[model samples]
Target chain A: MKSVLCILFTFGLWLLLTWSLDPKVVGVGLMMAILVATLLAHIYPDNPHKALDPRRWFWACIYFPYFLVLCIKSNLDVAYRVLHPDLPIRPGIVKIRTRLTSEMAKTFLANSITLTPGTMTVDIVGQDLYIHWINVHGVDAEEHTRRIVRPFEGLLRRVFE
Target chain B: MSETIAQWIIGVGLMFDLLGCLGLVRLPDVYNRLQAGTKCVTLGTCMIMFGTFLYGVAALDRPQMAVQALLCAVFVLLTSPVAAHAIARGAYRAGARLWEGSVIDRLGEDLHGVRPPAERAEPADQPAAVHHFTESES
Candidate 1:
């Protein structure tokens, strides 16, 4: 019941986001989301075959909105750089460590970083993460990761672990 | 009911977007700024987009633009936070610190092999280690 609700919630948000009142288009999108989500469920089915983490979903709902705001801000920042005379890109790669025990949270975090603009998740070494950034304030790994992650930890704590 | 109202909404939305950008520039560090950039700015842009959607309805029949703009918003919604998470994780892996100034890392107790309630039911942490990366250490 919970997993099914999760799928429905995901579908509803997606539909609202698309903002297409065109029933045909929305219906199609909803159907697609359901199909993929259901298939995913089967691939990791309930009980003995699969385990569902409602906490992760809860965290996902909480964390996702905040990330959206960051995206918009970053998008504008990048746009400014493009529009301005100086591109001001100070690209470099750095390494950092994590306290996240579950590989699931780590992987989600990795992929999240990649999706954001001007930053990339290069690799993961155990609990450590390797990132290529468009800029660096200093050479300290702990400081940098802390800045990047403070927004995420609470919701993530509720989520993928 | 009037163009003036639409104009006001649009202006407010733009201001929200602008304030977010300012936060991005002024915030102390990457992660802090990511908060300013991601949360405040995201709200600003969404508001701006929403105003435009309304304006389209009042001025022209460009509902398509509104819908498409909405779709763009959706894509951003699904992906942005995940991206931040990814970048944070990446930065952490790559040696970015939270702050030289902060004291508590709550994760310390949770991490020292103390499993979360979510993973405690089964003998969970049993995935085969992907590799022995000692050779890669310099």
Candidate 2:
């Protein structure tokens, strides 16, 4: 059932790209989508058989808008820092802790931090993530973690975990 | 009007890309440089691609071109952070020294086996063993 949905989604993407009423294009798209689903789907780390829930989808939808706002705000913030005469950056690597256990969730968290402007996940050791922050307001790890990691944690919990 | 909107979007993207480039030059070290290179460039490129997609869909009415732009944006979105991760890990492994202003060295404490090459001098307590550089060490 999951694989079928995956194939259908891929085929839908193909159709969207092609925008053709021709039956031949669809036949090719289906063939390609099936081939991809069969060959590559298992390579994805997450369980392909698990049913996707609408609740998760809802959280994801919420997450995207939040992320979009963060992206814009961060871009503007970084631009200001770049343009400032003092270049007001206090760069450092700070450690953070996360409750996320799955590799996919961890990757998502890392990618989110990297994209959000002032922070980048530099390394991960066990539950600890080393972040390279553009501005270091405080040396306390807990304080920095609260500032950096807490914002995205709840949404990610709902979405990935 | 659509053309003007596309131009403005593209203009914003160009400004971001330019700021990112300035960040690359102005930042102090490899990690700091990666911060600029990764975040700004990814956002800038994604915005540019998005603008191209908008232009195609709104102005040219070309679904295929818009899809192409979307695919580029998605591709950049997926790959950029992974690339940044790989580069950061490599730099840390290669013992790319941190900025003098850097507050902490967490990797130094966490990974006992991997030491910065400069700090790899044999300890006096351990009998000096002939060491061959592993692939990662080199």
Candidate 3:
């Protein structure tokens, strides 16, 4: 069932890419989508009906906009620093901890940090994430966690783990 | 009016791209350059694509072109940071030097030499100690 949905979704994207309703184009796209989906379906096997919880979907929708706002804010922040005459950046690699247990949630947190203002996630060894902070505020891990990781941690935890 | 808006968006994107290039030239180290290059370029390219999307939809009345522009924007958003991550990892492993003024070098110490667990002593008062993996005996 999930495979079928995946095929349909891919086929829809194919159609969108071609922007054509012509039967011949669609027929070729359908074959390609089916071939790709069947080959990859086992990798993403559904978890026995547990994946359809609407609450998670709602949180994901909310996450997108919240993340979008963060991205815009971060872009502006970086832009300001770049254009500043003194270039007030104080770059350093700092280690901070995350309470996120799931790998997926940690990934989301890392990517979010990279995209946000003055921070880039360099490496993650265990729960300790080494971030290249363009501006090093302080050395206190607890303080850094509060300012950086805590904001998205709750939302991601709710959505993923 | 719609065309003007699209042009303005494209202009904003160009400004970002220009600033990003400036950053690449002006920033002190590889990590800082990556920060400027990755974030600014990603946002700039995505913005330009988005401007194209808006222009196609509103000014040209062509949904096909608009969709392609949107797809390009989405693809850039998804892939740019991953590229940045790989570059950063490679740079660090290859011994790319940080700026002379850098305050902390946690990864440098951990990967190049070991900091005994005692030096990295966590706040024992926290309940999350058990979940924390002590420094792997390198």
Counted clashes in each candidate structure: 38, 0, 0
| TM-score (all chains, Cα) for each model | 0.45, 0.80, 0.82
DockQ of 1: 0.06
> Least lDDT summed over 10 consecutive residues: which range in candidate 3 chain A?
A42-51
Residue A1 shift from truth in candidate 2, angstroms: 8.2
Misplaced by over 4 Å in model 1 are A1-38, A42-69, A102-104, A111-118, A158-161, B1-49, B52-72, B80-138
Per-residue lDDT tens digits of candidate 3, residues B34-126? 898888888889989999999999999999999999998988987888788889988787656576656677787778686444543443443
TM-score of 3: 0.82
Global lDDT of each candidate:
0.56, 0.79, 0.81
Alpha-carbon runs more than 4 Å astray in model 3: A1-6, A22-51, B114-138
Indicate the docking level reached by candidate 1: incorrect
State the lDDT at B59 in candidate 2. 94
Local lDDT at B9 for model 3: 92
Writing each residue's lDDT as its tens digit, candidate 2 over B1-138 gives 987888888888888889888888777777777877877888889989999999999999987889989988988987898899889888877666566555556566566644543454334333344332221331
Tens-digit lDDT track of model 2 for A1-161: 55676698789888877878698999999999999889877656566433378888899999998987887777787788878877787776778899888787888999899888688888887788988887887768798889998989899988887
**For residue B114, what is the lDDT in candidate 2?**
49
Give the deviation of candidate 3 from the true structure as CA RMSD.
8.8
In model 1, the Cα lDDT at residue B112 comes to: 41
